[model samples]
Target: MDSVQFPLSTGTYSINGRKYRRTAYQMKVATDDVAQKFEQFEDTPDVYDDEPSAGCLAPPGLPALKKKIAKAKEVKEAKPESNSTEPTEDERISVIGGKKWIASISVPACFIGKLHGMNRRALNALENDTQCRVKTPRRDENKPCEISSIVSLECVQRCLDRIEIFVDDAKKTARVTHFVALPCDQHEVQENFEVFKQLVLDSEHFDASCKNPQLFTKSARLHLTLSVVCLFDDVDLQRITEAFKVIEGEIKEILNNKPMIADIQGIDMMNDDPSQVSVIYAKVSGEKIQEVANHLNRRLIELGFAKNEGGDEVKLHMTLMNARYVAQAEKLKKFTFDAKKILEDLKESYFGTFQLTEICLCPLNSNSSSEKFYDKLAIMRLA
Candidate 1:
């Protein structure tokens, strides 16, 4: 027997519809290796039974061959199973710090002046007491106190933390401090807060110039000055007077209800006890007089500021009030002129006659040197 025909190639095979002559190399590993290896070679006689049956089998090394076939089937199934596995490492968690605190900065000029002008020791005591609530706290707490004190303490703490307490001998300024926080690679936390602090330090705030003499007394003049008065010719003045009379009639009717009167600053006046007050000023061009009348008519319906019963229009007044006091003065006697009297006279003389040319929005800074009035920041002309 040939060596190739030995048990080395002794495997069962099955035949299909046809057979082909094959070369010696092809016989070793043929294209239809499974069918050739599992071909059955047993003989059997036909029976008359009409029942269907499974295919016949060969007994030549069939047990060992079935084991090899089953092993190959398992390997084929495992290729995709191994490829479908996922990674098995643990994920991580990260932490983010909190937001930085911010506060605006302004000098205690107004509040401090109010305390000093009235000689109110209690006010000072109150102010100091309020400040002390946050200051001079129990040292045992070992914590910073007061807003300002905390800011100052933070500066000192920074220096101490870095162990840089050397003060400059010539300049008399505190030494610079540096700290290397181990967890924070880049000082991003402190840098963010520093940016916020700088913004507050650079913001625009009310300031007082000590060189100005009129800032605190009754004569205390502000930098910005506002003047409002009724302007009209003798003819237009008649129209205003007539309109005033018309509104006065309605006011008299409203007064019939007998509203409560109060001594407001020694001046008797009707009080509505309004919860909130809003100042409204409507400016119209001369060409828009009809439109202005229509607008006022709607306003009168809402507030009933008109007479003639069903008419919706209200009286048009140029001046809202004669004189207005924007700032409170503790020492009125110190002013050169009587501000109260000036305001009263200005109010009494006010008659709605001024032509609406432009509306100005101004900012009051402080008392100006030339006019002793509040200065304007920038005038915006109404479009």
Candidate 2:
């Protein structure tokens, strides 16, 4: 009988003058045995026997095999060490100082006025449980709440989580709460509007029954509304501002870097009957002005901040008078003014043309500034 011989290069064995190929099972068993030997060697000292067993003989590809095994062992050893020391997602903390943690959350501006029992209950519970310092913005303030320092970092995180849930719920049912407009703030334009306003107040054709001084728009607050939008909070305001900033270049391009001239001529009522009008406005017209207004309306609608009431064309007009400004008690009866006579008298009234300098995103029903301009959330300069 011939001695069995294994050929390292061919991966075959010769026995009793016969040759046989190594099966997958045999290769797997050999690999397992080698791995077990390597593990046992790692645990023991570096001492080696002068003479090795026949089964422990190195294979033809031992150098490459040793390198691969060493790399795999290193990776296996490092994995547990890394996992044991690093924190999990839930365990992570945003430390501000020694054992102090801080967390913040955004609350929509509309949430202040719309707060219900559920919101109050949640907020009260958070305050009582965490004893955390909760700083929320006022109704008029566009800012996020700053929550900091509780028994532990987890408490602050919990406070933020609850607030976020409340804010998310409020956002789902939010309405259009703002508008975008091109402010007619030129000194010349304001003086012209003041003249027009005085004319309406003193004209014999103006109806005495509807001539409440409060019905007139402030000269400083005069503007041609582009579109109305729903801005729930500072985050929404920031997003819309960024969106406008991106398209501002397009608006500037349309104007060709020249100051856009808006022609304010003629007087009109929003309703056809002029006899029972709730809104009186000055007609705004100019090729470039209309283009910019239409572009803004379209972009705002596409961004989901505004709705498309009808066509893409934005009707440009600066509101001169509104009956909604009437006293709260009389407003319930739906007070309106007779604008028919005033319309006939000022039909072709030119309130003068002025350069369009800036467009503003302003909050509705906000208190006017000292200069009598509506508080602007954002302003885009055209010239």
Candidate 3:
């Protein structure tokens, strides 16, 4: 009991990382003591924070500095950024006042991942400072190494395994009509979504501004958004539907052996900061998941209804929350959530696996209004 010892006096200091990540919302602050003590459990014996010594997380020479600043609200004590999770005040959808048909695949709701070992004090500091964010690992650390060497031939063999996820920014693109997708049921994944939602809402690490619990996502609305399609004409819908029919048997054939299974893991932000998050999604992974996505995207692109955004490369993610509105981009930017901290805390979380059985064609009403984001237009199942 109480085996550790603290020789230095109780005071405050600050910690800063290398640079600000553009994809995440973060609040920066100083000090590894008081608040940081909780985030960084192990501390060096150095009396001052001005110079980095051994066993520190930051690089050397970048000393922890003494700085006095007003204590912002603690995560637990701070009120939620949004009174309700269902954000109704700001509607940030790109296409509004109408619905479009698209193809998409649905993954099970419980497929979210899980993580552990986060510093609470770090979360508190981030919550207080509002300008800093957690830095993700470099390319290889996040994904399997793309390049491999053939030792026998003494030659390097590979292209970097990367998913080129653009913002669907294809100019001169026709109307976004139908998308291919795999759908999930609320009964299968709602309970976990609710739990994760509540955890984010109650955690002190989160900034609750403008967040609505209702906006998290309805169980009925859970599904993976595959690709954005462009319709361009009244006859396009028929063509798109027929194109799907053309390859429906093949897709089912791929999934026919058994229900496709995958895990729904932890959460991540679409951008660097959580505060300006347009979408929050759970990481998903499984065997041959890439093959399924590739097949679907190939067929859709072949018919000229969808763009080959990633080309046999699929980003397997399930969108959990959104702050988008048809008419409110600037307003939404001002309202940031603590998705970063929440993601860190649950980095090792695993919601469970999804036995994906079928794919569907659904209609998108408005990206802003997600209560019933899509209506089931058609369904095709594996034999």
Q: Return the top candidate by lDDT.
A: 2
Q: Report the CA-based lDDT of candidate 3 relative to the real structure.
A: 0.53
> Can you write out model 1's per-residue Cα lDDT over 45-116, one digit (the tens) per residue?
223224443346365577999999999999888764332322212111111121111111221221223323
lDDT digits (tens) for residues 1-383 of candidate 2: 99998534424568998895442221122346335322231222323333453455675688999999999999988775322222224443455434556655676666754432465775566777777777777866777777777377678777777777777676556666888988887787778777877887887777884567888877888889999988865578789989979889889998888888889888888987888899989998876888888898999888878888859898888898888878453656678888888888778877778777888888887786736788988888887
RMSD (Å) per prediction: 28.4, 18.3, 36.4
| Cα lDDT, model 1, residue 260 | 18
Order the candidates by TM-score, highest first — what do you get?
Answer: 2, 3, 1
Decoy 2 TM-score against native: 0.58
- Off-target runs (Cα >4 Å) in candidate 2 are 1-175, 327-333
Candidate 1: C-alpha RMSD after superposition: 28.4
Q: Count backbone overlaps in model 1.
A: 25
Candidate 3 lDDT, tens digit per residue, 329-382?
A: 356434445566666686666565767766677655545455554655556664
Provide the lowest-lDDT 10-residue window in model 3.
Answer: 157-166
Reference-based TM-score of each model:
0.18, 0.58, 0.49
